[model samples]
Target chain A: MSPEATAPPLDESWVPIRVHGDAGGLEVDWCHLGPERFTAPFFDQTVEDRLRHPFALLFQHRTSIDALVERQRIRPGLPVRGLVFHMSRCGSTLLAQLLAALPRHVVLSEAGPVDTVLRAHRELPGLTDAQRITWLQAVVAALGQRRHPDEEAVFLKLDAWHALELPLFQRAFPGVPWVFLYREPLEVMASHARHRGAHMLPGALGLAPREAAGMPTTSLDEYGARMLARICEAGLRAFQHRRDAPARLVDFTQLHASAADLLPELFDLKLTADERQHLREVAGRDAKNPVLPFEENRDEKARGLTPEARAQTERHLRSAYERLEAERQGR
Target chain B: MSREAFERFRARVLEDPTLQSALQATPDLATFLVLAQRLSAEQGCALTESDLRDALDAARRTWRERWI
Candidate 1:
């Protein structure tokens, strides 16, 4: 037998959910996500919801990266409408949720398969950049497959950590409009302090080249601040690199006030009256958990923030934050 | 529950989009299993509900244990 196994050619009924193993040993886990739109807050939530389906459970398929790539050759998926990069806790979730509310849009919020392919370089030594951009493109294209006749556009809200891999993502989908959404440094830090993301930990994601320089990040607060700084700097660097790149900076400070108009204008999306009504309803609920009502907690977070953490955030993120603000305003 | 019988039925399903579409277009599992078993027997490969249940249960187990 060959070193790898080939899976069945993807039909419209089956979609890949995860990419397992490394370059030498690779496998793709698939489930029937067809006939079901991803309206949940996150990709996993959508997958979890489908767990109760007989089709999803009974007809699981496993394949190699080759099959994913092959499917792309046979049939391409919808062209991307936008790519969203965020500094976590920003209005990124809100943006994704709003997009999902529209019956004509397919929103993939922080999908795992995309992250795995983007980080393929980390699994193999001596590789400076992504080892499998082809797989990345294929997986994304596969997910963007139109399951509903009304599906008109696809939007991907990448993870906060993906800000570091901006160039790599840009390379995969050139000419696609992208946005970098951020909030006040202090507010974002406080939110993470309460319920931290794994990216906030030192070397949790196998230290990027920047953190590997021996910065000696000791505490969770410092680590989180430094990581935030890296994301800010990376976003700024990408913006300055390509002045003509279709990139926008979304502060999301007054997200509720500005998003209704800002989003469609920035992405050049035309919304119908029904879609507008749907957006209003979606915006009324928690973007991350639709079960709860939406509430703005910036004031609460500021009040709860420790003086020490605020100082640490300033020490690390002050310059980057100011530069980002300047760029957002200047543009 | 012969493996050969199920394999034959699966092969025909893969080759026939119309059959696959009919199966996918079924409204519910009870209806789907009835259609699937009937089609399996029509293709000169009879597969009982027990056979499909065992196969799908095994597939579900493998999928649940898949690495995310």
Candidate 2:
């Protein structure tokens, strides 16, 4: 773990997907993502497409994670320009889509391998915070390798529960302007009631006792609302901890004058007039499925909330919602 | 594929974008595997269908389930 050592270059197309114990030793498993553009809604979707072929599978590579660390030492990848964290079922995908509309940007939407690295500490016992930070940097460098010569910015849109690990990400990439995007709790809750993400399950994450205690022993919909409340609060608390942060607290609703104001200032991004128009087109499509047009009925998505889900959201998440709504006027 | 042949074939494929694209363009696994084995044999890294199946099964992800 010295500062001066370096390793030979590894191909950027074969990105690492898993970091785990391999026959009692730690290793990284990589899949070849080829040269295709990341136009998919999620990073995993892109990898899954590759997996549907023999080319990406038969040639998978396995090696010590240190190999990537050393490879990164030889060639440090793009520095992360911005981070996007969101409560699930929120508009984070739309924001990520907008950013990825141009070829100059590399946007990783809820990349699973990055999530595995972020949570590696839970499984790899006796791992120190320093090691974790170094590993995080290495992993990010591996993910951010320049696929296109014109690539300028690398943005990572993290999963909802990742907000709970804000301290870790902030520690890994300090001074990187980030935004915590969220929606009305009932809307988020309603969306989850229809199709629940793994994090919404009663005990899927084996979350902290405090989070577990907060969840009711009722329906999964109520649990999803409470879980969203916890995630939203975590992001707000992390941002509030450092008011000087180059960050924004964006609500789902456009009530905030600064909502979706975007990162020309914060992320140090520049867009031409044509690029801006292209992003407007990107935002008009569905975040999860870009082939489909954006559903105009924003309220319709939340209209299916069950009575119990609505009650739980109001009971548990109303305060957090109000406090965040106040951010609009303050902005 | 034997370990040496598999490794050699992979090395060759990694350096050949044309082959990569051809294999990627296959409509299904059967066609892809046939093209892959034929390509390997052309390069002196010949492998049987069982070897390809074994390699797919040995992958960490559920390649069999994926195909199924």
Candidate 3:
């Protein structure tokens, strides 16, 4: 064979490339590559080249997560100042979008990559403490890319499932502040059922069709009660674990009434006069709909819980809410 | 979905400098579906038909921009 032919496809000229993985999977793009075939070395070089560069890695392995955490811990660049936690559909989107519109802050809204990373390591039996730390580290690294040092902060609106993983985040970026948002339990249940679809399993409000089909169907009341219980439990757990952390609990009702006053106070963010005005405009628009339109169907819909189920959900939520409030007040 | 099919589809789209430029400019739903349709046809796959249809529906619902 001719030497030219044998020498491997002359490492296709360095060109920017975007590699898309499967749906709901990681997507990465790079500016350029040197003359090297797609090999291990090429991947290593790509990683190095993209250092301090942001790339979304969906379903990142625990090992990868560990490397990212270590990098941030040892050589921390900018602290991830903003993190938002919530039960799904609790006005998180509005808050995140508002924050995103502000200058000097990069907001990753419902980032698919975050979900992928959590799902990747969640199934494993028992990752060591160090391994678990790394998983969170990778997430921070992926979410923490800043083009300029002056870019005030990086904000991440975490996946609902990540409520269970708050401790990991706290351990990774201890300096970062977090906020948790909640709505009335009945309203939350109704909105979740209407928008996300119902599920039979515990804590499974937004199960996809495939996921729902995999589990045995239960009574709508039972499903609603279970979902509410799980959400309350998750919230309480997150609250208890991060008692000392800078956190705020914004009731959905209060947020709807006056987000302008609540949001700036919660985050301690200093907005310019124009920024504050812009925030008021956005908040006013969002606050107009205090009750989610779908709440009316809670009684008539298939996912509507029976009176007994409703009572159970309310009972659990009341206990959880009291505990959360007490913890917040340092009781 | 196969490697060969993916490579072929990529090549076909990249071959057209205009489409490639459009794709580079905006990787939004419209461009993605157009690229997917072209690739699916080149791959001799039936899956592309549904993909294109869904993409059209999504674009109409979200962006309200018709492709054809």
Q: What is the interface RMSD of each candidate, in Å?
A: 4.0, 5.8, 13.6
Tell me the tens digit of each residue's lDDT in model 1 across A251-301.
877566756656776678898777776677778788888899988888897
Residue B27 displacement in candidate 3 (angstroms) = 6.9
TM-score of chain B of 3: 0.37
Tens digit per residue, CA lDDT, model 3, A1-331: 0011111111122121222233333232222222222211122233334321211110011122223444445444345777888766567766776676565765655554455445443334454555655555554454444544345576777766566667777776675778887766666665554555323344443344234333343555445445444555666776666655787766666666766667777778887888888777766553214233313332354255446656655755556666666665678
DockQ result, candidate 3: 0.06
Better of 1 and 2 by lDDT: 1
Looking at model 2, residue A98 earns an lDDT score of 74
* Candidate 2, TM-score of its B chain: 0.79
Q: Sort all candidates by TM-score, best to worst.
A: 2, 1, 3
TM-score (0 to 1) of chain B, per candidate? Answer: 0.85, 0.79, 0.37
> Whose lDDT is greatest here?
1
Model 1 residue A57 CA deviation (Å) reads 2.4
Report every candidate's CA lDDT.
0.78, 0.73, 0.50
Each model's DockQ? 0.24, 0.39, 0.06
Question: How many clashing residue pairs appear in each of the predictions shown?
Answer: 0, 1, 5
